[model samples]
Each structure stands twice: as C-alpha cells, then as structure tokens.
Target: MTTSSSSPTVDHAPRDPADGRWTPRLVLILIALAWPTQLLAAGGILGANAIAGVAQAFHTTQVVWFGLTLTLVSTLLTPFVIKLGDLYGKRRVMLAMTALGALGELLAALAGSFWLVLAGRAIAGFYGPFGALSFAAVRDVFPARLVKQASGVMGSSVGLVAIVSPFLAGWLIDTWGYRGVLWFLAAATAVAFALIALLVPETPRHAFGSRLDWPGGLVLGGGLTAVVYALGQGQS
Candidate 1:
C-alpha cells in the first residue's frame, strides 16, 4: 500500500508575546498619536489668515499667544505626565491626555475671547508626549523583534505628517476661514480620543508603591518651560 504525503500546515497569524494575541489596536494608537503633531503643525499655517480674524475678535497679542500657549504648557507638564503614566498606566494617561487635547480644541473652536482660546491651548498641550507613550506601549505589548520595526514606522509617520500638515492647514484656512483650523483640530482630536478609549488596553504599571521623583520632574518641567519661553520670545 502507498501512503499519501501530508501537506505542512502554515500558521497564518502572528501572536503577541505579552498576551498571546496580536491586535490591530497598536496601529490605531499609533494613528492617534500622529494626529496631535499633525494638528498642531497644521494650525501654524493659519497665522496670516486666521490672525486677522482673531485680532478683530480679541487682540494681536492673542495671536502670538495662540502659537506660544500650547508649547509653554506642554513643556511644563510633560515630565509630570510621563511620571503619572509610569505610576498608573500609560494607556490610561494617554487617554486622559487625548481627552484634554480634544476638550482644548473644542474650547478654542467655540471661544469668543482670546483668554478662552489660550485656556483651550493650555489644556491642549497635554498632547506633547503622546508619541512617546505610544512607543512605550508598543514595547510593553509587542515582542522585541517587532518593537524596532514599529518604532521606525512611527518615526517615519512624523516626517510624513510634517510634509502634509502645512498644505492641509492652508487649504482649510482658505476654504472655511480661521476657526476652521480649530474645528479641524477639535474633530481630529475627538476621533483620536475615541479610538484610544475604545481599542487601546492598559499596559503593566510600575511595581506597587514605587517612589516617584516629583521634585526632579518639576525642575525639569520648569527648566524646559523657561527655555521654550525664551525661544518663543526670541522669534518675535
């Protein structure tokens, strides 16, 4: 009797080592992280066109503050935010940050006063380290082999966003007017927030009751703020 040879079976899907299940949520989180930088950079083009409307509604200084406010607040809060993520969970912190950013953009879109817009921007500054948090999440959730490739993808996306944002912002400004920039940012932020809330899972946290260096974080935040402030002022 002749026996037929059996065909080799192939595995179709890769598994995540952390949980033994690969997830599409990692890509979703990366896309969410990309939005913040793109939104912020895109809004820069609105300066010439949007500034006039803002000045008429409020004042010229508000225009300058529009650009400065988010950077300043983000510089001050980044360290504390990272520490908070370590203690609690990066996914939780990232979701909170995304929520804050969305709220800020919504406030900016609706605000009738310059001070309110500044308030929105300050809250929006929470987005600064989202990319880093996302990278950390990848490290925590993905195997070592995938981490490097995933990180390269993330880095490349930033460069791509840098190229796209200006033209997109300019077109929005030209089409709908200045508030369009804020509206677009708000919409993007809201969508990102939703994706994070729905798909991303909380990663492992630091050991329970670990000591946190609040003082060092504070100093770093303060020094960074000062440096950013000086640079922003020098640009004027």
Candidate 2:
C-alpha cells in the first residue's frame, strides 16, 4: 500500500517567551501603554478646569475655543490616525503623534494669544486616539492568556486618571495658572513618549495592503464638525 505524504504545518504568529507569566517586561509595557491613556483622559478635565484662567490670560471670551478646537480636531483625526497605525507600525505612528502632541502642549503653554493656544490645542488633538492604539498594541504584542488582564489594566487607567486629574488640575491652576497646566501636560506627554519608545514593541502585523478612505473620512469629519459647532454655539 502506498502512503500519502503531507507537508508540515507552520505557525507564523508572533510569540513571547514569557507568555504565561507576568514578567517585568510585560509590566513595563503595561505602564508604557497606560500612562499615555491616563494623559489623554486627563486632558479634558484639565482643559475644562483651566478655561477661566485661559480667558483671563488672553483677555478674550473666546476661551471656549480652547476646548472646542481640541474636541473638533480630535473628532476629525482619530479615525485617520488609527488607520495610519494599522497601515504603518503602531509604535512608530504612536511615537510620532505623541511627539507632535508634546510640541502642541509646549506651543499652548508659551502662546501669547488665544488663537495660537487654540492652534496648539488643535495640534495636540493628534494624541486623542492614543488609548485605542494602546489597546490594539496590547492585542498585537501580548500573549493570548495575558490580553484580558492587560486590557483590564488599560481600562482601569482611565478611571484612575479621572479621579486624580481634577484635583491635580485644580492645584496646578491655583499654583501656576493655566499655562502651568499646559506645561504639566507637555511634560507628562514627553514621559509617555519615552516610555513607549523604550518599552513598547511594534506590532508585527500591519494592513499594508489596505487603502485609506480619505473621502469618507473628510465627509464624516466635516459633518461632525458642523454639528458640534452648531451645538457649541447654541450653548453660548
């Protein structure tokens, strides 16, 4: 009798040696991811708390634009940034965005006019989707058994930041004024950049074959901006 021969199967997925245990590297990676997630959550709180100081400094009632610009830009860019992370490597894209965010924070801190501060906030919005990126990175790099735990830690970080940021913002606003708040954010984002750069690994899988739908993104962003702008105006 003749026997048929079959080719051996190969598993190509990325592997970690410490798949089943909590390793130091894993903890560092979690911290790297969670810190930026915290910063992103904290930004809204800090902005809201510091609005009066911003108005006083610039002597303009249009301080509303500080929050509005950030919200609008974040709404517009989050999808594009996420798609870019999928197409390119998540770590690389995340670093670039975080660096841009730090620069924006610095700009806002030093800006002499309200318009420049709004422009800075618009730039800083590039960092808005960082938490989503961190979650995707966890999926990409963590072992199957560790993903649930890692995700739980990431989700909990937001709650932690929410509880702490209001108090932190209030103190900063009291001590150094609104610019101090921006300075603090810039420093925190820079630390996040360093952590991610040093510890987080790039995702092995990428959707290089996929194409970005720019037209759809533009239409959606424009519609959302219009609606949000109208609502914001209505509130005033």
Candidate 3:
C-alpha cells in the first residue's frame, strides 16, 4: 500500500527532418539567391531598349544615370554588406537587402524626376552582396557533404537567369512601358522575399566578434571602384 503511482511518460513526436532537408526548399532558396541580381540586370538592359522613352520621361539624355547608379551604388556597398552579413546573420541581411531593392524598384517605377530614379537605383544597391551572403547562408544551413551540390546549383542559376533575362526584358518592354519593368522587378522581389521568409531558416553564424580590417577594406573598395567606373564608362 506504500507504493506511489508513477506519472505516465508522454511520448513527444519527433520533428520532421524532410522540412529541413536540401531536396526542394534548399534548391528554391538557391535560385532565389540570384533574384535581385537577375531583376537588376533585366531592368538595366531594358533601359537600353527604352532609351527614347526614358529620355522623354526624364527630358534628358542622361537616362544612363539610372543604370549606372543601380550598378555602382551596389558595387560600393558590397564591402559594407559583407561585413554586416558576417557580423549579423546572413539571412537577416539578405532580407533587408531584398526589401530595400523592392523599395527601390517601386520608387523607380513611380519616379517623376531623373534624380528620384537615381535615388531609387542607389537604394537598390542593397542587393549587391546577395550572392556572397547567399553562399554563406548555404554553408550555414546545409551539411558539408551537400554544400558542393548546393553551390553548383546556385552558380548555374546565374547562367540560367542571364540566358533568360533578355527574353523576359523584351517581353515586358513590349507589353508594358519601361516603368513596367520596375514594377515587375518590385513584384519579383516581393515574391522572393516571401520565399526566403517562409522557406529559408535562420542561418547559423560564426562571425560574432570577428574583426574587419577597415584599412584593407577601404583600399580594396577604392581599387574596385576605379575598375568598375572604367567599365561603366566604357559602356557609355
């Protein structure tokens, strides 16, 4: 009569492993990694197709400023973004970049002046570190054994987007005005942001307290800026 009744053990169910695996969600995340760049490339190229329209809208032949601002600002911000991603979480930085890119696209689409468009393009620079940040994210989320395959998939997606951007740009330009390209980019970025939010888990980071060499960063940034400026000038 002295024996105490033991409490029943409640068996908890294990979480689903497939949800965290690399089969589909990871693949989609990799593709989405290139979303911002793909949209930027398509919109920049569309500017050439709609040069006359752009000039008419801005009342200036300096419409090239839009593309240049988009590209250059992003380039200049890459080091900052890389360091931020390393210090914080890559996923958080990536989401911020996508959101900024979306805001930039919307601003460009509704722009009433060339300067506003330039501002929008500059805002879009947040997307500059996407590829690098995404690669780091893949490494954080996936196992070492799967990283190679994941990287290969992400790399190939860049080529695939390049191949398809021309056609996509042409179709959008033909169907809608150049402004529509900005709208399309905004929409695409929104979708990508949603995908990332829902599908991609928070990536593990080992970068806490890691020091950044400011002097080296500045030197590298200066050198890269000069080279990029030259390339942009060549295009003009």
Task: Write down the lDDT of every candidate, Cα atoms only.
Answer: 0.70, 0.85, 0.70
Worst 10 residues of 3 by lDDT: 7-16
Off by over 4 Å in 1: 1-53
Candidate 2: lDDT over CA atoms? 0.85
Per-residue lDDT of 193 in model 3 = 84
Sum up the clashes in candidate 3: 0
TM-score of 2: 0.90
TM-score per prediction, in order, is 0.81, 0.90, 0.81
lDDT of 2 by residue, 92-134 (tens): 8899989989999999999988889998998898888787688
lDDT of 3 by residue, 1-236 (tens): 59853532122212225644566655666666655545555555655666566777778977767677777777777787788776766778888988898898889888888888788878876765577677777776676677788777766666666677778777877788778777888888887788677666665444565777687777776678778878878865
Worst 10 residues of 1 by lDDT: 5-14
Best by lDDT: 2
lDDT of 3: 0.70
Checking candidate 3 for backbone clashes, the offending pairs are none
Native RMSD of candidate 2 (Å): 4.6
